[model samples]
Target chain A: MATKTKPNGKSEKNQPQSTRLWLMFPPKLITRPIVWELGQKFPLVTNVRQASVTDEIGLVSLELSGSRGDIKAAIKWMEKLGIKVEPVEINVIES
Target chain B: MDKQTGFMKALKCRECGREYPLAATHVCEFDFGPLEVAYDYDRIKASMTRSAIQSRSKNMWRYRELLPVAGEPTVGCEVGFTPLIKADRLAKRLGIRELWIKNDAVNYPTLSFKDRVVSVALSRAKELGFTTVACASTGNLANSVAANAASAGLKAYVFIPSDLELGKVLNSLVYGANVVGIKGHYDEVNRLCAEIAGKYNWAFVNVNMRPYYAEGSKSMGFEIIEQLGWKIPQHTIVPMASGSLLTKIHKSYQEMTKLGLVSDAEYSVHGAQPAGCSPISVAQKAGLDFFKPVKPNTIAKSLAIGTPADGFYALKVMKETGGAADDVTDDEIRDGIKLLAECEGIFTETAGGVTVGVAKKLIASGKIPANDSAVLCITGNGLKTLDALVGHVGHTREIRPSLREFEALIEAETKSPTAA
Candidate 1:
């Protein structure tokens, strides 16, 4: 299976990239409008594959399609908001 | 196909409520929420009556109306319907008033509760037109998938951690299924299996066939309720692996009530785990909803799923039913196996050991009332993991085949023949 990571450990700045991620939200961040903000703030495509939300936590299976830099920034932003993010297919794929 | 297809209308997302056609899929397209088998309860209500189920075959399929399969079962015909012993001596020993043992330790073919799930999964796998089946198992599931699939004439691929007990590994091999041992923990094996599931079209029982596979565990609950004369026990203590069996048993009780089989009673569900990998227990004790994943390090390899997929749901069921979760140490687990064996004459695997140990602790702490009826779910057979008790259980004397030697040994150990 082909992975979503940039090849050769590098990609042109303007080149488009796409990757699927498993996003985790702590109880405090679960109630926030994090998905809406991510969609509004980033120049990327947000395709949610799965989500589980309870009063204390939230988990989302999301795929973001955009430039590698934008994808990196989006993950950084989510991390800044205390959301734990990881590659969906952790072994073979890189986020 | 079975006429019950009308009863199972669609695969509904547990979180988002999205629906999809009945297929070999486990996740939703939109929210990745688990896809659960949806049933038209009205139709089931009309079709599946108490008398209707009681008159069916004795195996797990007796509750076929509630299972997710579309037709007659194609495998594991002899699985389930294990003895639900009254366990009087064990009950008295544990200081409980009334107790029952839902002993799946003697479960057919594979002597574990995994047979129930594997039976349903493979039957559905055949229904879905898959020629090959696979799974990411710790041990028992691998053994079950191998045995049931082979008997059903379906090729099987069992992936497991390389360090699984020899008994389990050979059990899979003797069934003539292809066994692959990954050089890592069950978590790593699971990750690789997930990637392989995406690459291959095989029916991975616990992965792609999960929706149907999990429903099979409901049969354990069904049998217990029926064996108790159509009444639910006041409490059910179950071992937690991926936390699926505990949740399914709870669903089984709910389904029974919905079908007018058992009286609606206030029953609590408790979960047990080995102390080495008790993520769910720790979370429940702290009153947390989500459990942080842990690195499993326990002799109870079968229940060593560190990050339980259904941990949250198991917690929800416990809270909804006013239940609790707890764990036992390795030493306590060994003591549990011996206690059940000596008192009730039932030998259970470590998962069962954890369950029995937790039940004792719960009763001692008054977390579970000793005055009420409780049922313990003994999921696997002790023979599967003999290493746990290799040096634990022993004979009084290794005597020769002579009556005089035996008599002398008995006299030495018990004081005299007239001691009693």
Candidate 2:
């Protein structure tokens, strides 16, 4: 649906219900299965678009599909765990 | 673009909080701020060491941990690792204790430092799944892209200002690229390429893939430090075109120290530009953070970036390092080319002349410490810009194949054999 609920507590123009975020995990969090946690913890559809991981850190480009409120909550939850969560302007690759 | 540089975090906006997936996109969708590749330096440091780097190939790709690419490099993989010559003659002329030349004039493939960026750009484009690559350049970049893309088997479309030298034009076309000669300066051509990049699926290296392309210049810095016995030079001078190389070299120094590969020795980074289009130099001398763009009208067409994209960052690095910027005239540029050639036997192009000429001024003016070792970056080969030497260099004498005439000419010049 085009209409979406306000998560920032401000009324805004309707944004897409499905979106993506670029998640950066610090060295301390690299060993955790965050992708599994993302799906188990949130009601949103979690798609791991890209992941580059090493012993020091992990970065994931993730796409989520769900209601506006659920997508916002998913990102908020990730940020609470010391993960940097920011929206991703995607590439046309794999399209 | 590839799967290997997994240390690269998401593309973050330079001005805003916007972030982007590591893609071909450059500008932030929200505020139009440029997107730069973010890396987990901690991860890179964990994966890198002086011995680890020394064990790898001798080319630029050996610093794969720091470059933005994720997977194996697939373009111009053998480029970089040019010689760093110690210039005792040039240093003595400028009254300096020591001087070194980072001679990218002999860079692999296209004989310029542009080969370094082109190698990374084309490799990133392939990693991003771009079937075609394009760029707007003056001469060196066009030649580099064409050559690297041809070797990589990717379609290339290189656009350059129509008035480039004949040698550069021929060099690009010989690489089997589709060369488009636009009727404008490099800045205008670059502006047009920025528009074209958004419309087409093709990658415009300096336009859309700039963050990755710019990272390649850091290898020059890496090589300089590594070749200097894993030590940072007290002072280094780099030529400024779009200002990316200077900024990247400074970043390389900082990153090296951060990684514990080099000591945290204090070093200064100087910038060189031609007087005709010396925006960064002008800004530096005036103590201004920003620079006014100028129309490029110098023989050093390669360093004639009027509206430099990385000028702000370049100026910041200069200020932070306590280094200064200076410019040289077209006449001085020619003299510099000849000076290096006659003294060191290295025939550098106009851009190299700009660098050496500015170094001379900086040393003579006591801007750079006369007692410390200085490294000047010579960026291109003189053969590529031969037109710059048409009236500048001269043939001293003409002799016929007659023994009598040869003896008479030798006597006229040298007075007598013993006095000769």
Candidate 3:
């Protein structure tokens, strides 16, 4: 018998994918090295394409490359830490 | 089908160099970058001369070569060419050297600038053999899409946030379009529309058909330069919803300069937003390249897109043009509406208030320079947002229909110190 896999079997969960996202850091999280923390906490490569930091807020446009499942987990962790994550653009819509 | 593509070369990705056929598509497959209409400038320059434009009908179609349609526009051909008023009184009030108002509040069919976009989108949709059209709107775009689709005898489904002003809702419903009120914000509506657009073959004006739809906004900029005696203003303040208008206006200036229609001159494109939902303005104020999305909570519903699609490009335009961005509070928006109405006799909606208010702030801060001339793009009419001015624009004093009573009231008012 074959070993049981996850019910919602996304066999391609380990497939590598890359996406661009905008991360917004509130005042409390501005001093925290969130990008470094993100890399350490997940099996993913993070590249900061653009960033702006002030005393009150920090906005970053980051490109992340990793397995689909790892990227999903990393984003979840970032959200738990109060980092606002949004896709760079909706794939189907252009303004 | 080997249909005529007019002066258009193809739809080219703005990020990558990839090109796609002129079809109902928007984003690049690999990079997901937005595609834009690439035109043959040499062909356009040869045909679209100043005299040619002047001799054509007083409508946006006069700049036919620049628009993305494959043939003569069969929809909303009468739209655009709204007046550009030299607002002397408004200039004095704002302490600016010169001021002008590009009033799209009087645009044909629909009172907003969205009509210009819808006309091009529907015309292109028809040429592409689409029988159904749709859009995700924040009231104004829905109104324009519904009206234009009705006029073109095409089916339309416009999705909008449920909490929009009653007047705007009625305006769309009156056109007999399927107005779907989503129980969410404009961003949510847009997201759902993106999904629907992918699943259905219908022409979503701002989704799959965006490259053509967005180019329609350039007509407003073209009209501005033409009305200003074929010159670009030193400063142009445009209110930001998706920020598409600001970017397209900048593109129009560049296209005109490249085509030798307007002499290459220096100009700045400033952006405005209501403080309650000012993602782009906030990012701009912080001197950033990317904007953080916000949940909108402003009375200026028309300019209340939290996740502006063109926010990145809008920022780039402002930076390249040496422009600035700012936001005004809800109260300030109302004050802006009142100021323009009282000073320029132009009753504009809250988005116009955002433009006027930000213009005042920029002028006061010297970002726009009080000595420099500027033009305010008033994109919508005030009547659609009457709910915002219900108790704020002053109440009428009821009077009995009697000459003696009216005389007593007038005498009492004259005796009062605050009468003026």
Candidate 4:
């Protein structure tokens, strides 16, 4: 459950920055309450950024960010839950 | 760039008039009323002329001298210059003298008028040295924020109600933005974004960055007047959601008159909303001074904010302008969408349908005069909300590919006319 800290040593001036990721799912995957199930994997997650389901898109994007390794593994585990993950590129990262 | 001549001294609260340093703050601490970027009118009046503006590019940034942002624009360089079409056929059908369609549906990249606002927000965010940009949106806004942010090389986090349409989801995700679907309604999603905005140093476009963001919508009003050869419409019908666009249009018209760019004339502003979730229209109908929030339930999901942030101001503007607010049924919304597309070849989403539908209702009810020119603001493209119209249209004729099949179809079509 320990988070992986990057050895890049950019700066500790603020908190270790984490980029939020968006994951979408099909309706059947969401009907089984799989998004919350994915949330269970990231025990150290500072927050479940967002989650939702609609008629037009079925299950919409859910954003989460916190510990690096915890977020990566939680996302990988979400694939098992039938969720599709897309890495949202950030142009500028700030604490 | 000489900031003193372009931007006003500072942004001031609409209610208290308390001034704040020109950062991105929107709300006032004393009354919670939203603040607006006030400009030095005399300076603009002296500099801005119809010929001066017309000589520039067709984009919204053409009014850069009047916009709030100080430096170079970082987004939506090609966003504005949308077509302002004359709806002659639609005018005859609706019994109006002159009607125009502000076709913002084809706005670049994301295809919603929100691109106008996001373009300003992202430009200011970069100028402030912020690394991340984010927002709480219904659907079109998320698409715009994600796409514009991606194009500007900024990380974007877009929050939305989980029940958004598929096209919008794909639009945002394709831009590689961190799109979040909150489990609650749009208001809840907006609240969560506000909380996150306080905790993080990110630029939340409609939140902390709203003062500059809302200013972007003024271009629509500016474009309409300029396109009409520097004459203001006597009546304008705008869709009501956040109410920012409606109020901003009103502001632009007034500024034009003040600057002597247009002749002084009395303008009436009307607002439209779906009956399913019409807090502002309901308040206006009841002749109430304040809007009472209601849980939204409508196909026009884009305008389904039960407690709109600017509902009060919207009501006040309608009353002051001697304008009326009206709502249309869901069936009418679909009809409005079809009516616009069929008449003017403009495909708008449900919000646009609400505007057109209510415009019809208002004209029939004698709220809008037949002699006045009316412009309907179509904010988003129909493709974003195609599911709302699925199965509501189309013909089903089980006929073989032959002259006999066609004859039979014509005979059957005459025998049983489908209800439109």
Stronger candidate by lDDT (1 vs 2) = 1
Q: Write the per-residue lDDT of candidate 4 for residues B1-420, one digit (tens) a residue.
A: 454324556878887799887876766654444678888777676667767777887799888867877766877788887888999999999999999999999988778888888898888888778889998766788888888999899999987668766666787899999987779734334434655776789898877788888889988898899887788887899998867788989998888888888899888889999999898898899897666556678999888766566776888889999989999989999999999999998899999999999999988888998888988889989988888899897856565779988987777768887731
lDDT for each candidate structure: 0.84, 0.81, 0.87, 0.77
On lDDT, the stronger of 2 and 3 is 3
User: Total clashes, candidate 1?
Assistant: 7
lDDT of 1 at B79: 91
Winner by lDDT: 3
lDDT of 3 by residue, A1-95 (tens): 34345567745667677766767898899999999988988989998866779876687878789986798788778878988766654422221
Q: Return the lDDT, model 3, position A13.
A: 68
**B325-372, model 2: which lDDT tens digit per residue?**
999999999999999998899999999999989999999899897989
Per-residue error (Å), model 3, residue A49: 12
C-alpha DockQ of every model: 0.15, 0.02, 0.12, 0.03
Off by over 4 Å in 3: A1-95, B1-3, B163-165, B184-188, B417-420
Candidate with the greatest DockQ versus the true structure: 1
Query: Which parts of model 1 have CA positions greater than 4 angstroms off?
Result: A1-60, A64-95, B1-6, B184-187, B400-407, B416-420
